[model samples]
Target: MFDQKDLDSIRESRQEWESETLEPFLEKGERKERFATVSNHEVDRLYTPEDVSNIDYDEDLGYPGEPPYTRGPYPTMYRGRTWTMRQFAGFGTAEETNERFHYLINEGQTGLSTAFDMPSLMGIDSDHPMSEGEVGKEGVAVDTLRDMEILFDGIDISKISTSFTINPSAAVIYAMYIALADQQGVPREEVRGTLQNDMLKEFIAQKEWVIPPEPSLDVVTDTVEFAVEETPKFHPISVSGYHIREAGSTAVQEAAFTLADGFAYVEDCLDRGLEIDEFAPLLSFFFNSHNSIFEEVAKFRAARRIYSRVMEEWYGAEADESKRLKFHTQTAGQSLTAQQPLNNIVRVTIQALAAVMGGSQSLHTNSYDEALALPSEEAVRVALRTQQIIADESGAADIVDPMGGSFTIEKLTNEMEAEIMAYIEEIKEMGDGSVRDGVLNGIPQGYFHREIQDASYEYQKRVDSGEEVVVGVNEYTIDEEADPDILKIDPETRNRQLERLKAVKDERDDAAVEEMLEELSEAIDNGENVMPYIIDAVKAYVTMGEIMEVFEDHHGAYQETASLA
Candidate 1:
């Protein structure tokens, strides 16, 4: 970008200006001793062409839709279409959540993102003893195909894309979805959406799993392989960094850990004898967009660049789609403040803008009232409207990679890419050149936990000492405030769900259900792809709990030991 003479002259000029101008100003006053991002990374005062001198426009960041896709994934980006506004919504019974879905769709939401209750996520029937007092507490509870039917009563499965935010039992939910599609006469080839079937991340951060890591990973691989052959348009897995960030990792850790987990899955699928090109295209990612706008945008760019390069250079991927790193962005839920809850609207707006500038394929904006409870209908409307305003009102979407040429952005992007790749290399070495083995090894050994724990601890310390200012949390003092209207789960939700589960059991043919479950158990024990068997069981109205019991009986339950040290 610059000749040696020009670089020397700029360096000399910077020195002179710093001494003559900056020193005098700094002597008078300064806001803080150090300026840092939300992740606590130190920020420099200024950036120039010298900062990004090493970047090659073509090799590092070609045009959108090209290799090393730093600019954006598609050629047109928002010009082709604004990202899908997919608000995450679910609570109480399936019928209730379905009504909320209709409400959101009527308010201009483009896609659906489901949130399952803890019982459903844990693969337990609503009537189970363990599910008492917890049914439909966090999200909707689904016991059988009956619940799924009521969940999507009027929604056309073929027309609208739906994203399921479930892990551990993602295969069960996925089977229910496929069975629904089949019943609706929608071709498996035309079925499109994503499954958050990332169990590795669950072990690393989210702490949600039904079995041990190895078999859980095998199940994830089964979905990928099955999707490649069946539902080609559907993404079998969404490699997630959202929960990792929510667990208090730095932005760099979020990207590194998530991508490492993704590569591990890729390696596992390849080891299973699946072609890279066949499965890579359907693989998608989910990331958190935090308050640090510039850093978030750069992180998204670096992610695309790294993923494209690795797929091409390491995996030898042939198809263009195989190399493209398409992802969904959700505004950081961990950033919202409970004290001044309304302030989160501004935070979400900035985060959503960052995601748009970063070129997210789909987005879910957090409601301002989320810090309090499950977002009220009014709150959800506001959240969806945030995306609408960004797409239609704000000119941010008019240009692709709107922050592309900034010297600061380019420098940060380069640094982030290098740091993430280095972390990945370290993990790869842990497994003797296999990312899958390395992640599995690291999880039990607490490598990832220690790293994220250290980062989280450091950030918390800064906030406690007032080094990092979190509005309404530390810096701003608030006295009292009235509570906003909270979305409450009905007390009768449990009884209703149990009754529905019972009806399904009573009406369905018991012999057929038993037969399907037997076949599913056999398939699992034989180490064959259990997706088809799971689908058969679900179509037979076999309950999620019943299906999961087979897995637990075979693999046993996993009890994680805490590793804070």
Candidate 2:
């Protein structure tokens, strides 16, 4: 954007200032020598247009809402409508979580993102022995459809979009949601939400697999096909790189692995005779907004450009919406620190800003105290208000992709694009047609392990050498102490949740439940879509464990014995 004369003048002024003033001052050892961010490629100085000489404005970054959407997804962007503020809320029993959800909605939350406890996430009923100590410690305890009905008791599903953070048994949870919507007098086509049904990421990063790889992927593909026909407004899969980044992948690795997993899903759907345009429009993404502000922003921009090209050029997606990559972002949990807990608010704010600059459709900001426990009401409110303030007062929403034309940003965007493509080529050359195939064969897992090891080693080296400075950790050690009271789930809550599960089990018709389970199993064995039958089982008050048992008997459990090198 700058002319050659202007660039020369800037360089001349910078040299004069550095030589005459900066060097003399720094010679006294009075100022820090490190910059805030490090580039992926080895470089010692600031970037110039020379670094981004190959950028073509029309081809690399078209107008907002246009194809090859490197700028933003919508025409007016946030000026027309701000990104949805989705707070991930759940704790204790369904009733407790329902109260919290109502509180957030009343407090100006634009969307709801449910967080289920480990037992619910694992498809176990609260009454199970395995669920004893973990009924509602992490999130809400959902044992059956009755719990789901209670969870969204007074909420209107058709009015607000909901996102469920679950994997492994995502199909089962999705069925519960469908059943709940039916009870609320909402048609299947009117439901708008997302299911984290990306099973490949589960095996590759989160270690939350239920069935074997092939069968798990089969279930995911089935959901995609069913959603395309039944619930067109709902997203069947949210390919997530958040967990992969949390598991210690670099920013480039995060983008590459996530898009690779997405490509694998697209290939699977095509193999099932589904058109790319039909389902590609419904495909969405989830990513982590980490501490690297500008790099994370560039990562999102590059991801959109690369994904658009892949969809339009490789997959033959003709529609503009089908080629556009829509995504949601959550602040990085790994970036939060327990020490100097209040400082986490600033950390979350910066990360949320990065996500907004990158054109996120929806966002979930982490609370200051999240690293300590499930966030308190005070903490979550602040998190929600962070987005509200950014939207209403910061004036960032007035412009679309405001940082799109910067020399550094454009250069970083191109570098990130090339880095991601290199990884894709590597995965393809490994003899697997896609990353999912490579992951199913345990190749990506090994790659992830190696990358994590190297990153960790480098991080430790930096820390030990006193080159990396953490505010409250290594640099400024304080003898004074500050401990904030955190919210804790009551023990009685678990007891009450268990009692409710048992009461439902005792009151429901045993014979009818058996019949529904039998039908679901038969549907599974016959290779028929199991959503309808699963919904029937949910309505019958069949416990989560019972439904999972049926699937386990038919599909078998995944047993991973491959050791990473």
Candidate 3:
């Protein structure tokens, strides 16, 4: 956006300054080493307009809420309203987690993000033999619709937005949400929520798949189609990069791979004859905000720009909402450390700010002690307060794209865009120009796995060599023992959950549950939308394990053959 004469003048001045000021100072050897970023990119002493001379204001960065949304997605951005503070909270039994949810809502959290326990996430009931010690160890143990009902006991479905962080049993979890909504007398169309129904990422990173990859995709596509027609206000799938990043992908891979998965979903939906505009608007993203402020901001900006172009140019999307990229961001859980765990509060603050500056629609700041255990009540409150201070006191929400037009940020953003586009091109080529084929086949072929492995290997090498410094990890050493009060899973949590499950089973109509399950099975076999059927089954008090067994019987189970070497 700089004039040619002005750019040239600035470039000459920069060169002169570098030779006279920078070079002379370096010759003194006052500084022993060159500066490098967390990504191991060498940092320039200074950035000038010359670095962004090729950028076109109109095309690369028009106004916010416009094409190629490099600036920000919304025109007024946070000035319109601050981003949602959606602190992810779930632990122990449904009653226990429900209390935590109530505490967060009372603590000014704007949205509900549920974290399911391992058993529930794996499509296993609390009483399953395989689920013995893991009932509510990681998150809330949701065995049946009765647990779901207790999970939202006093919560108003129509007034709040709920986001579930479950993958393998997404259909079952979605069924519970819908059934709960129905019982609450809330219209299907009025329900607002997001399901992390992204199965591709599960195969590529998280390893949380229930059915095989191909059939898993069918389930995801079915949810998208059903949401388009039934629950228009709800986001059927939150195509996520958080787990990918947690699994050790670089920032570029996080964006490229996650968006590639989103494209795969689009491909499936389009193949099912659903219009791009119809379901694309409901497509939302989940990204990770690591400690690198500029990199995180650049990554977020690049994601919006690339998604808009892909939607409009590649998918024939017309509506603005269909093309606009909206996302939720969680502070990097991998960045937290156990040693001097209080240091994590500062790390979380920085990461949370990066997410805010990057224009996330919602944010979840990880609890400082999360590296130790499920967040204690005090730790989670501090995490929520981190976002509150950023929004209310920091004055960061007064403008749109606060980092836009800065010389370094613009350069990094341009670099991020180009790199992510290249990755997308590579993924498409791997799939024979179809993102669907590339991701589906690439999973078994270890394409995504190998890339992330290589990136992580290089990153760890940097850390081990002291080229990259983590504050409390390699740089700082505290000899004193940390005595932080940490949250521990209660020993009785599993028993409580199992007892509740037994009660629900005993009280429910067994005949009606069987009938509804049969209907669901028929719909799954007949290629009919199973959402309505699933809703009916959950309402009949079908346990998650039972429903998942039906899916396994029909769709078969998957064992990923990809090697992680």
Highest lDDT against the true fold, candidate:
1
- Which digits, one per residue and each the tens of the lDDT, describe model 1 over residues 1-565? 6778888899999899999999999888788878889987777889988898887888998899998789999999999999999999899999999999998888888889999999999888998898999899989999898899999999999988999999999999999999999989999999988999999999999998889999999999999989999999889999999999999999999999999999999999999999999899999999999999989999999999999988888788989898899999999999998888889999999999999999999999999988889998888888888898999999988999999989989988988888889999999999999988999999999998989899989989988998888899897868867878998899999998888888899999999988998998899889999999999999999999999999998999998886456
> How many clashing residue pairs appear in each of the predictions shown?
0, 0, 0
Which RMSD values do the candidates have, in order?
1.1, 2.8, 1.3
Candidate 1 off by > 4 Å: none
lDDT at position 330, candidate 3: 96
Ranking by TM-score: 1, 3, 2
For each candidate, the alpha-carbon lDDT, in order, equals: 0.92, 0.85, 0.89
- Model 2 local distance difference test score: 0.85
lDDT of 3 by residue, 111-196 (tens): 99999999899998887788988989889999888888889989999999999999989988998898888899999999999999
Best candidate per TM-score, number? Answer: 1
State the weakest 10-residue window (summed lDDT) of model 3.
30-39
Residue 6 in candidate 3, Cα distance off native in Å: 1.6
TM-score per candidate, chains pooled:
0.98, 0.93, 0.98
Q: Candidate 3, overall lDDT?
A: 0.89
